[model samples]
Target: MKQGIHPDYHEVVFLDSATGYKFLSGSTKTSSETIEWEDGKTYPLIRVEISCDSHPFYTGKQKFTQADGRVDRFNKKYGFTK
Candidate 1:
């Protein structure tokens, strides 16, 4: 291990704005904002758009798309051989 060459890893709170979920984890990321967590201590707060709590995949509701259909449509329009 090297000394004085690694980023500081500290406990921080990641807040999901969509679901109002907060999770505490160690990260090297920094932020100017802070918030009080459930432990009654203040930690750096980072707001994110998507998290596992609100993500469709984790919730078992992922959207399905037909990739082959779209490719067939493109081929028909451009006369490309498959």
Candidate 2:
């Protein structure tokens, strides 16, 4: 496409704080923080709260919502007329 008008795409590391998992992938995101990977190379590091490693859905540990209980609580507190 257009030259000199697009963001630079480079290899970056995404670190998951919860699981301490690091993934190397290409992204347009830039950061001043850097870290030495297991391969003895330094790359831009991005700290993330959740990733596939720690995500509930991906790990199959997702919590189920109590829909009926929440509805009852809301009706009792607000006196919902219905």
Candidate 3:
């Protein structure tokens, strides 16, 4: 391990802006924003646009072409029979 060569790693709060979800984790990223978490402790706040809570894949909200009759359209385009 090297000294004075590593970024500061500390517990920070990641806030999902869309879902307003927040989680505490350690990271080397620095932020100028601060937030008081439920633990009554102040930590750096990082706002993110997407997280597990708001991600389509993680939340199972992903839309597949199978549901919108795209297969039928494809079949018609290719002159294939059902």
Candidate 4:
């Protein structure tokens, strides 16, 4: 435990830029912006481009390529039919 050597860790609101989604989380990062959270308290605001709410993976909007077996790939590559 050291004194005066650690950055201030506090709760801040992370804003998803694309979706305008907000969430509260603790971080050492600081910001000039502030936001009123659901708890009726004001905290520093941090903007982020991506979050679980807007991300393709978490939102189930991600596109998955068709999985082809080795044999299928080889056959397709060599123009094999039947």
TM-score for each model:
0.74, 0.75, 0.76, 0.72
User: What residue pairs clash in candidate 3, if any at all?
Assistant: none
Q: Where does the lowest 10-residue lDDT sum fall in candidate 1?
A: 61-70
- Inter-residue clash pairs, candidate 4: none
Quote the positional error of residue 12 for candidate 3 in Å: 0.5
> Compared with the true structure, what per-residue lDDT tens digits does model 1 show for residues 1-82?
9999999999999999999998999999979999998889999999999999999989898765688789889999999995
- CA lDDT of every candidate: 0.93, 0.93, 0.93, 0.92
Instruction: State the lDDT of candidate 4 residue by residue for 1-82, as single tens digits.
Output: 8999999999999999999999999999999999999999999999999999999989999755445577688899999998
- Give the TM-score (vs. native) of candidate 4: 0.72
Clash pairs (backbone) in predicted model 2: none
RMSD to the true structure for each prediction, in A, is 5.0, 4.7, 3.0, 4.3
Prediction 1 global C-alpha lDDT:
0.93
Off by over 4 Å in 1: 65-82
Candidate 3 lDDT over residue span 1-82, tens digit each:
9899989889999999999999999999979999999999999999999999999989999978676588888888999995
Candidate 4 off by > 4 Å: 64-82
Misplaced by over 4 Å in model 2 are 65-82
The residue ranges of model 3 lying beyond 4 angstroms of the native Cα positions read 65-82
